[model samples]
Target: MSQLVIQDLHVSIGDKPVVKSVSLTIKQGEVHAVMGPNGTGKSTLAKAIAGHPDYTITQGDVLLDGRSLLAMEPDERARAGLFLAFQYPSEIPGVSIANFIRAALQARLGESAELDATGYYKKLYEKMDLLKIDRKFTSRSVNDGFSGGEKKRCEILQLAMLDPKFALMDETDSGLDIDALRVVADGVNKLRTGQLGILLITHYQRLLNYIVPDFVHVMHEGHIVRSGDKSLALELEAKGYAWLKKELVHA
Candidate 1:
């Protein structure tokens, strides 16, 4: 099974240090949720691992099945089975969802290998049906004038179609309403059948209610200060980050 291993990771945006000394090993079939207050570097960690050009990895390494991800470009990382679901899905006007995803799937195939169209659409429709999305959505421009829920659902659609070994989901529930949150969560849960490892980054515990995490990690400032099971998220919901801060002070 493929796994993502992060070791002593340190990230910087320009001269400002963000993620500091964070490490995690996510094996397939596991869901690890990273929780923290704003500015604690949860998003930075995800972006850095995804090879976002803005963030620099000053120290440490992120590995996929023992290969360093830092050596690969963003597209290379995607093709290597590492996927990032952005907090904000970009608007690609005039590009139909079908064409965009088909292009991505095609790129994964080498120059010599051509994607079969009939097979691609068949798989795409099957995924859309599984997510209970209307088949007509395939013709719409990607996230162009889409509602907040629609944008998030689109991200989930891409996730479903790509079927990456490891997914770094950065604040997926950020702008979602309760109903949309459930729908997106249900789609993700359906895909979690021991073939993928997910790192779900969010600020609220509500997202955890539907997509229960196997491990819960709390980030303070720049490093992970605490980690536990699902109950830890409930605890965070009950006692906020300030409470964790107080505990850290006493520790």
Candidate 2:
């Protein structure tokens, strides 16, 4: 099984340090959730692992299946089987959804490799159907006029199409209503398999209600302060992060 390992990671943006000495590991078939209040660097951790240029890794190493990912570019990381679903997906006004995803698939091929358009569309249609997305969506501009729910579903469609070994989802439930949340959550649940691992980052515990992560980690000031089973999430939901802060203070 493939493995993603983060070791003593410290990340900074320009002069400000956001993530401080964080470490975690995700093996295929596991779903790990990272929850924290605002400004805790949860999103920063996700972006840094995905190799966003704005976030610098001052110390520590990120590895995939025993290979170092620190030197690779963002595209390189994707090709190595890492996927990051953004909180806000960009609007590609001129690009059709089919063309965008097809181009991404094409990049994963060898220099001389050719993509089979017929088979590609067949698989694409299947994934769209599985996610309950209409077939006409492929003709529309990527997320250009999509509703918040549609946008999140589009991200899930990309995740299904790309079939990455590990996925880092950043605040995927943001701005989604109950129905949208359930649809997105169901799509995610269907996508989870022995071949894929996921790191879900969010500020609230509601997302966990749908996805039910295998492990729950609490992040504070760039460090994962506490970790436990699904019950920890409920506990955190019952009592706010203030409870954890108080516990930490008294210890």
Candidate 3:
């Protein structure tokens, strides 16, 4: 089974520490949700694992499929089967969605193999149809002039076509209304097969309502202060973080 292991992770920007001693393990077919207030390093942890240069990993290791990923460059890590869905999807001004994804798949094939255009578009349109994305989206620039919901849907579309072993979705429900959230969540749910494990990071419990997680962890001050099954998310939703903080302080 594919696995992503995060062990004693400590991250920082310059000298200011953010993620402190956070540890977790996600296996294929499991969905783990990481919840916390802002500035608690949720995004930092995701970026560091995905090899973003800005967030320095002062300590700890992130392993994928039992191999250390710390030494690999970001693109190398991606080609090795890790996918990170950014909180803020960037706009590729001139690249169409079809060409962008095709390039990514071609990279995975290395220099010796030729890309099959017919097979590629067949799969692309299949994924778009599954995700309820319009076929015309293929010709549009990646995330250019898309609404917040459209951007999130585009992210899922990429995820579907790439079919990574593990997906780190950061705040996927951000800026999405109820309808868009359901659509994005439905697309994600369809993608959750035994070959795919997910680490979903979000601040609000409402997102959890659509994409139910196998496990829920509450992050506080850069550490996961609480963890449990899906019911834990319901508790967090009912009581809120303020109650959790008070309980932790008194405990």
- Which of 2 and 3 is ahead in lDDT? 2
In model 1, the Cα lDDT at residue 171 comes to: 97
Which tens-of-lDDT digit does each residue in 1-251 have in candidate 2? 79999999999999899999999999998999999899999999999999999999999999999999999999999999999998999999999999999999999996799899999999999998898889988899999989999999999999999999999999999999999999999999999877899999999999999999999999998899999999999999999999999998998
Looking at candidate 3, the ten consecutive residues that score lowest on lDDT are 189-198
RMSD of 3: 0.8
> Candidate 3 at residue 225, lDDT?
95
- Greater TM-score among 1 and 3 belongs to 1
Q: What is the overall TM-score of model 1 with all chains considered together? A: 0.99
| lDDT (CA) per prediction | 0.95, 0.95, 0.93
lDDT per residue, candidate 1, 109-206, as tens digits?
97999999999999999999999999999899999999988998899899999999999999999999999999999999998989989999999999
Off by over 4 Å in 1: none
Order of models, best lDDT first: 1, 2, 3
- Local accuracy of candidate 3 as per-residue lDDT tens digits, 126-176: 898888889998899999999999899889999999989889999999999
Task: List the pairs of residues colliding in candidate 1.
Answer: none
TM value for model 2? 0.98
